[model samples]
Structure formats: C-alpha cells, structure tokens
Target: MATNRSEKTVSVLKIAAFAALTPMLLAGCTSIKDRRGYVMDQALTTAITPGLDNRQSVEGTLGQPSFASQFGDPVYYYVSSTTEQRVFGQPEIEGHEVLKVAFDAAGNVSSVTTAGMDDVRDINPDGDKTPTLGRDRGFLEDLFGNIGAVGAGGMGGGVGGGTNGS
Candidate 1:
C-alpha cells in the first residue's frame, strides 16, 4: 500500500545521502602536499660557476637566497622543502634541499655545495628548561628569592649593619 512506497522512498533517500557524503569523508583522510621556499631549477643552479659567478650574477641566476651568513665568510643558503600533511596532523618533510654558495673576500663564488634530506638533522631539545649550574627553584622561591639578596651583599648603612646608625 502507501506505507510500503513511503518506506522504499526513505531507504532510497538514505543511500543518496551516504553517496553525497562519502567523498567528503574521504577528503579529510587525504594528505595535502605542499612545496615551501625556493623552487629549484637544476639548469640555472648548475650554471653558477665558482670563479665566474659573483654576487650580482649569482643573484641573477638563482634569485635572492633564503638567508645569508651574518658573520665570517659570506655564504648564501637556498633552501627548499616539500611536505605532506594530513588533517589535524603535523606536516612531514617529504623532500628537502639546501644549496650553499660560499663567497670569498672578493665576493666571488668560492664553493657550491648541495645537501639533501640525508644532511637534515632533527634536533630534539632536552626538555623546556635549559640546564644550568644553579639549583632548581620553585615558583614562590623565584618570586621572593631576590628579596634579601639585593641588600644582603655588603650593602653598607642598613638597619643592623653599619655602626648602628652612630
């Protein structure tokens, strides 16, 4: 009767709803691939010559570097990375490259070195606090620790120290 047709309609609607949502649910589990930093061009990078290429020509060849050395010899670092990330997950480096171009005192390229993921190192710090020679202190100790230290160190002419205020 009419009840049997209504039940069939409800079942079909349920299937249609699931079909519409199946792709969306799968999309959440899919990984997102991203490329960050400098895009490497093999031809242009290889064209850079140590003795021939200077800062200006190098910049023209490879564009601006990711960073440069602040001290010591002038070195330009071109860094690139490809990472994959899932929903609510940290991005993992799938590929990484670092090109180091060193310049001599004359600002001409001295050396060109390339590093891959094999050179990448994960540095896990030892907890949040930096290890120090001093003893560990609590919250209240830190807040009030300097209370007596300021005047305790031979601060002359205090209440009980210098000739009792003669």
Candidate 2:
C-alpha cells in the first residue's frame, strides 16, 4: 500500500513539472521579431504627391526620412526592415523597403518610388581580410618589412627638421 501511494505521488509530480515547463520550452523555439528604421504608414506615404508636395509638405506627411542623398539630385530615403531571430542566431531580414522621394532644383518632389525585398542584396564578405590591389604580405614580412623602409629615406627618423640644439 505504501509503495503504491509513493509511486502515484511521484507520477503526479512528474506530470505537473512537465506541464509547467511545456510552455517555456515551446516559447524558446519561437523566433523573435524586430522592426528597425522608419515605420511606414500607408496613408501618409500615399499622401505624398510628386510636383505638388514639396520638402516641407513631405516632411509633414512622412516625418523625417531615414537619410538623404548628399550629392547629385536631392533625394530623401525612407528605409524600413523587419527581422526575425532565433534564440542564438543572427537576425534574418524578413521584409525590407526603401521609399525614395527625389526632388528637383525647386525642392518639390519630382518622383516617388518604393523598392521592396526584390531590391535587397545579400553581400557576403571575403573572409576577414579586405582584398586590395597591393601585394600579399606574410606575418613576418609585415612585421619586418617596415623596419628598413621607415628610416631609409630620412622620412620618419626625426620628429622635426630643426637641429637638436635650439
């Protein structure tokens, strides 16, 4: 009788522990969603009309842009991205958008264009070293190569051109 009761109690405790931990286990598997940059609003974006809407009006409609072109024709870029990340994984871009509002010399909106995920490009860098047009140097060469070159041309040996005595 004592054995039967202890076994039943142990089984009930096991079931209760599993029930409490089940939700947490499932929650850990869910991907975390994150939104970055300017949040897009359909109505506000639609309100912007080229030629009619100027910089001020567009700013009032869509608020400030994510960035603006510094050179060439003036353009305002409203960029947004939605990413999902697992518990210990890098965030993957699920959605991306870039709204480009170009302006003429008059500062009025000349053209409005929206680019979606199709314009998104994935760039994988080549290892840790940056590729350059120079020669490939080894660890020893990099350390000792500069030894003879620095003071050879009377370049960096002295701090100033003046004599040591004032």
Candidate 3:
C-alpha cells in the first residue's frame, strides 16, 4: 500500500510539472505565420508604390516593401524578419531582408533595389550636439531672477490693509 501511494504521488507531481511548463514550451514553438501578416501590415508593404500606379495601365509590379520612410523622397521599403526562441534561451534574430523601390517624377517606378543590414547607415551616427543658445546665467542672475517683491499693499497683509481690524 505504501509503495502504491508513493507511485501515485510521483505521477501527480510529473503531471503538475508538465502542466506548468507546457505554456512556456508552446510559446517558443509559435510559427512565423502567426505574426507575419500583422508585421507585414504594420510595415506597410503596399504603400511603397503609392503615386506610381497610374490610372491606365500597370508599368511594373514590385511585390512588397519593408516600410515607408517618414521623411525624404517617396520610397517604399519591404523587410522580412526571422526570430528563434527556445526554452531557457533568449530569442535571437535568425534572418532579415529588405527591399526598396523609388518612383520617378512622372510617378513611375524609377529604381528597385535590395538593401542588406550592412547597407543601412545611421544619419546621425555619432550623436547630436547640444545647442548653445546663449551664455549660462551666473549664480547671482539666477537668485535675483524674474519674480519681484509683492507690491506695497495689494493684499490683506500689505501696506494697504483693508478696513478689517487685526
């Protein structure tokens, strides 16, 4: 009887342990298809050829773009990302791809090209310089700053105290 009870306890413990770990294990196994559609929409692949598509005919089809630039000449960009996650392991980037399409003055595809991670460059690689609007104020200038003392008697406590007796 004692042995049987011990075995049952062990079985229950195993079940509980598996139940606790199942979610985390499943989380790591999520496939890219689950996130691909949403990511693609957020990246805005369609807007890449906005003005270029004419009313009469289609000049060319440049599949998708990674994202559209907030500033600069109108350009559409497309990007693909792959990530791997494992139990007790940090998610790591497995792969990435980007494509860019630029339109010409007449609103037709001007150029199409691919850009890898290495090709991208930070506009302000170093850092922004702090602006020097003017010279720093001295200690005295800060202490005797803008505020002036209360006028002679504007309030009850001032020199022009109202008729109310103290």
| Model 2 Cα shift for residue 109 (angstroms) | 0.8
- Quote each prediction's TM-score: 0.77, 0.79, 0.39
lDDT of 2 by residue, 25-71 (tens): 99999999999999999888888998899999999889899999999
Highest TM-score: which candidate? 2
TM-score of 1: 0.77
Give candidate 2's error at residue 33 in angstroms: 0.5
Query: Whose TM-score is higher: candidate 2's or candidate 3's?
Result: 2
TM-score of model number 2:
0.79
Worst 10 residues of 1 by lDDT: 157-166
- Residue range 106-130, candidate 1, lDDT tens digits: 9999999999999989998778777
Off by over 4 Å in 2: 131-136, 141-166
Instruction: Order the numbered candidates by lDDT, best leading.
Output: 1, 2, 3
Off by over 4 Å in 1: 132-136, 143-166
Clashing pairs in 1: none
Query: In order, what lDDT does every prediction score?
Result: 0.93, 0.92, 0.58
After TM-score superposition, the amount by which residue 57's alpha carbon in candidate 1 deviates from its true location, in angstroms, is 1.1
**Number of the predicted model whose lDDT against the real structure is largest:** 1
C-alpha positional error of residue 139 in candidate 1 after TM-score superposition, expressed in Å: 1.3
